[model samples]
Target: MDLQLTGRRAVVTGGSRGIGYAVGRALAAEGAAVALVARNARHVEEQAARLSSETGARVIGVAADTGDDASVAALAEAAVRGLGGVDILVNNAARTNPGSIPDDDLEAEINVKVRGYLRCVRAFAPAMVERGWGRVINIGGLAARQSGSVTGSIRNVAVAAMTKNLADELGPSGVNVTVVHPGATRTETMLDVAGRRAAASGTSREEAERRMAASVSIGRLVEPEEVASVVAFLASPLSVAINGDAVIAGGGTKGPIYY
Candidate 1:
């Protein structure tokens, strides 16, 4: 399907790897000019160059920490300058420090997830409003619903609320804001978590992964492209009416609600 996204300018945070990288590739496949943002300069630039070569899209990379206001502002400026303007913003950067308990340093999680998201949105949304068209896809997580033992559950819940609030605020300005909950995707983080669970259960990582997969209705982990495809669709003209909605890309989460 032609998503009618050719020539659209997009910025994706944490675009160096995992789901963010997949999302960037998906957008580029639709012929959109993409700017990749990540804290690691070399990795981000390398990925951007590779994507540009592979997809033949105008792909640029900016090294900036989303947790810092100055860095986020600079990233926004760089994206607009590089892409001519920003038509889509994918707030995909997130941190899940399971070791950090609530009583410990909650600030670290807040700084990276909550503050970082807000900073990027604040820096980029005005331009979208001015142009009168934009798509903001926030990568939320299933933790928002299950709030399991994961340390990032609180932050995910906050992100879900922020997604709804931003969708409401930006909807009137011709910007569609939506959140996606990609549950148990095959990413580095997921593998690490699986290993941890395996150690805790005195079982192999593969076995632990299998157990986790069995918990889902589809009986398997989600693929990064599955989530990315949804993101691309949401950014495309096809989903103009899907604002303020949280689409769960999980393999039918273990819940009564459709999610």
Candidate 2:
């Protein structure tokens, strides 16, 4: 499958590691030029260099905090200037701070996940609309559905609503917008979550990982590349008709229509 992505340009937030890096790599593999955005300059440069070397694709690194409007605006401008224009935008940056119930800051979480997404979309979608083609894939979470145990459930729920809203607004402009809910991915963040769960359960991290897997229908954690594959599909021409849909890439979520 060609994906018909050659010569296209994309910007992926949080592209230094984990799911964001995987999506960047996949897009580069499909022959799209990509600008990888992250707060850490060195990490973003390293990933961009690596992906460029591996796929022989044009990959640029831009350092910016997506949570800040100024930073996000600068990043979007840099991407457009570097790549000519963006045909795809992947909003993958997120933040989940850990603290006691009374100390947790839902506002900070929402600022990064929800506001950051909206800012990115606002900065980039106009270009896509003018071009009459775009792909906007929001990297959502399973917490959007199963909110009971998740600490950042509020942020995820807010993102779910925003995703639908953006999809509706952009769909009429030739931009296919969709959200992907990746469950329990094997990323650094997931490892941190597992560690916390282990300490709470009075068990080892290994045991907690096993328990987490068992909780899901599939007895394993989802790989970042697995979610990336879905992202690639959504960004490809094959998924032009999948707008406004929230697709779950979790290893078979616990409840029906988990999104």
Candidate 3:
């Protein structure tokens, strides 16, 4: 499992922490030079430093707001200069604010993940196409496959549609584009959610965690690194076979078979 990723360059949005950080670590471990992009400069830099030290890989942090056009343009330039041209772009930066059925205003939130992802892909994918080699793994959510939040479903399904279209357009150019749907990943945000659940249910945080984990078919919530492992593979040349597909990395949902 060499992944054949040595010397390959990668750009990961939302790399300051959580799932993005985990993906950075995994990619670095597989010997890919990475640019960690996030809005918080200091936080992203610190995480980059740690990942670089641990994996002995070239990892750099670039601060930028993906939802902003100017910021994303600057980000693409910085990534090119840092990693020496992006061979892999992981669109993992997203806003996870929940919306209601009546939905007051989710456009801004949805735009950040949907439009933000599109911005990053637009900025970087062309270069990959020119080089005739690239991997674009867009992070979606399980809501896309189910019916719950209207906004969530819309955005995630939008990502899937975008992936298929990109794959169709880029396949001839050696660029593989795909989307991943992760449900209730084990991250700091999940910890915050568990804490809230604990307070609301008047139970211990540990109990809340168990309750949340038990809801999954795997009998536990999937770790960030677990999801990252999938991204890392999808980010490599080894993943040429999975283009335009939606890989679920949420430790499997309880019931409802998705094929």
Which residue runs does candidate 3 get wrong by more than 4 Å?
A: 96-102
Candidate with better lDDT, 1 vs 3 = 3
TM-score of 3: 0.96
Best by lDDT: 3
Candidate 1, residues 180-237, lDDT tens digits: the string is 9888898887888889999999999999889979868898899898899999999997
lDDT of 3 by residue, 149-211 (tens): 777788889989999999999989999999999988778988888888899999998898889
Number of clashes in every candidate structure? 0, 0, 0
Report the lDDT of model 2 for residue 239: 95
TM-score of each: 0.93, 0.92, 0.96
Which sections of candidate 2 miss by over 4 Å? 96-103, 149-151, 195-204, 255-259
> Which residue pairs come into collision in candidate 3?
none
lDDT at position 258, candidate 3: 60
* Residue range 14-131, candidate 2, lDDT tens digits: 8998899999999999999999999989989988999999999999999999889999889987998989989999999876333222226666767788899999999999989998
Q: What lDDT score belongs to each candidate, Candidate 1 first?
A: 0.88, 0.87, 0.89
For residue 2, give model 2's deviation from the true position in Å: 2.3
What does the lDDT read for residue 178 in candidate 1?
Answer: 90
